[model samples]
Target: MSTTPQRLMLTRTDGSPISALVVDDEAVLAEMVSMALRYEGWTVTTAGDGASAIAAARECRPDIVILDVMLPDLSGLEVLLRLRKLNPALPVLMLTAKDSVEDRIAGLTAGGDDYVTKPFSIEEVVLRLRALLRRAGITTDDGDSQLVVGDLVLDEDSHEVARDGESVTLTSTEFELLRFLMHNPKRVLSKAQILDRVWDYDFGGRSNIVELYISYLRRKIDDGREPMIHTVRGAGYVLKPAR
Candidate 1:
């Protein structure tokens, strides 16, 4: 691979440069993550296979790692095990194409901090990275403030969301959408507003991205509970405390 990793000492909002290692056999996916992290002002390194991933981890000692579960040389789980030996407390986010919960368990059991299935959005990746960094002691002045409506609480500092005292797992995009809705409460945010805010202006510009992710949020955030997210007909969507 002729892809040279770009390392920048760019300052984060907290005034610190974060270093990240991205590992995946798919060159395009790896580059996609690297570029996004760099845009977030993180210094990034990329490796195409498991062996190269291990080598890069040892060399850079990134604060966080985004690793593909499927790699040509060794499985991402194996990479995680080897990485743990070097730094057991490392926060590794596992990326996989598999839809199996067992696969997610294996990655987490092997010391991975979180999981992202393949065909994921870049917005999701960046959010996951930010959450991992925050949990790893990097402070975020942005999401650190909490948003609460009734029983649902989003604690940005801890990267945790709980509704009626139960935890909800959300993709990065889902979290952002929910955050926007929570911040605005009862206001109906139009599709265009959602597209511009939750995603990059060009990031999945189709209104369908908003619809698709709303479905995702519904399943996780509103399922098995009274719905807080409501479709406002031709206007957009709204989130109000279920009363």
Candidate 2:
């Protein structure tokens, strides 16, 4: 519920093509990181220090960034703070050698959405980056919505929801999940798929978070009308306009 928009967008290509800045003082590792991102169809730019990273971020305005915490000229945290001032919506993934709980907490508190520790697998890093992007509302498709299913009409850009032509209030998470379901109406989404696509994490992989949120959505979207969201029992949930 306290999630902030990280502002990541995915491209249509099977490759997760994106523009990303990699900031690491170690030239070899910097090049390696850049190459991995490039392998995913991403455009890679490298900066040897925090100062250069900030400058590049301003110039390039990339969709996401990979920042090394131990930069020569400036720390990654400092760079993150300054960069957010420049573009608060910028998505930053911190790279750290420490792997300590304190470091992770600091990075998230200082504005980085996610992090990868030193000597990480290219595949895991890519997955985490994609997860971050998905949570930020980016996907392989480019679709924005402003319409109704049943009596509920939702406007995404405006963060407005209406039932029977009357507006309704919803938490940010609820609103986002509803938008996702509405966009893919009549598609039965399994809980695992929904967890991956919507919540963006495994989250123990057995929690009822999805069911709980769906219940919240039903209350707001179908409290006084024919249910638009239906459970398939052992399968998952689907949103369809009443026939």
Candidate 3:
């Protein structure tokens, strides 16, 4: 039961044309979405299938992408996996007709930034796009920049991490999880909360992915050092400066 923070409203003064790519098997739907996005003054591109979506993404390097779950050639999840390997920071919004918790979880696990159900309002889609763009630091009011706690730091812009003057390398998922924890430091975050915030709607509480990744983070940030992330009995996990 993962959910994002909800829609965002942006003013016309945000400036610059945000580039986007839409991948869906439906031509009419794609064109319609493109037109709406264009109306917002964004540069939009379309790909009818997964393979072409990947190709367009590589060539275009869009700031955001709207990926439909069902594609004629490849599943949207498969396309997402490929896209993540190609560009981990690419913000992807997944569109699907299925609204089951399982379906949502699967989409999140595939590396989506947000999820929008089919037959949705165009305004809702625009809002989600704006929210993702804002989170990625492409908005006018705020920027992603770098996040830090004590000696540990997560550089959102450079995708790098360091603590106590030592470099730490983490996988993309690990980095995302750590960043979420750092962003919400000292807040008791349940597995559900972590899943929602870090993985978006597509990750249903399927497996021990969060626990496994927490262990990974501990190894890097806490093992053989002053502990920063701690587990509260029957509660959840918390990250804070070592006491």
List pairs with backbone clashes in candidate 3: 104-202, 105-202, 105-203, 105-204, 108-202
Candidates' C-alpha lDDT? 0.80, 0.78, 0.80
lDDT string, candidate 3, 1-243, tens digits: 111211222332356578899999899999989998987778888999999999999998888899999999999999999989888988999999998889888998879988988877674587678778777777653333556677777776567988777899999889888877876777888888787666765355563778889999999988788998898877889888765
- Clashes per candidate (backbone, < 3 Å): 0, 0, 5
Residue pairs clashing in model 2 are none
Top candidate on TM-score is 1
Q: Per-residue alpha-carbon lDDT of model 2 for 152-220, expressed as tens digits?
A: 677655679987787889998898688767756778888887777666777897759999999999888
lDDT by residue (tens digit), candidate 1, 1-243: 111112223344468788889998888888888888887778899999999989989999888899998899898899999999999888899999999989989988889999999878786677677777667765454433466776788865556888889998877778888877876877889999888777757455568878888899889888988998899899999887877
Each candidate's TM vs. the true structure? 0.59, 0.52, 0.53
Model 1, residue 107: what's the lDDT?
Answer: 88
Cα-based lDDT at residue 3, candidate 3? 19
RMSD of 1: 10.3
Compared with the true structure, model 2 gives a TM-score of 0.52
Off by over 4 Å in 2: 1-17, 141-243
Question: In candidate 2, how many clashes are counted?
Answer: 0
Off by over 4 Å in 3: 1-15, 141-243
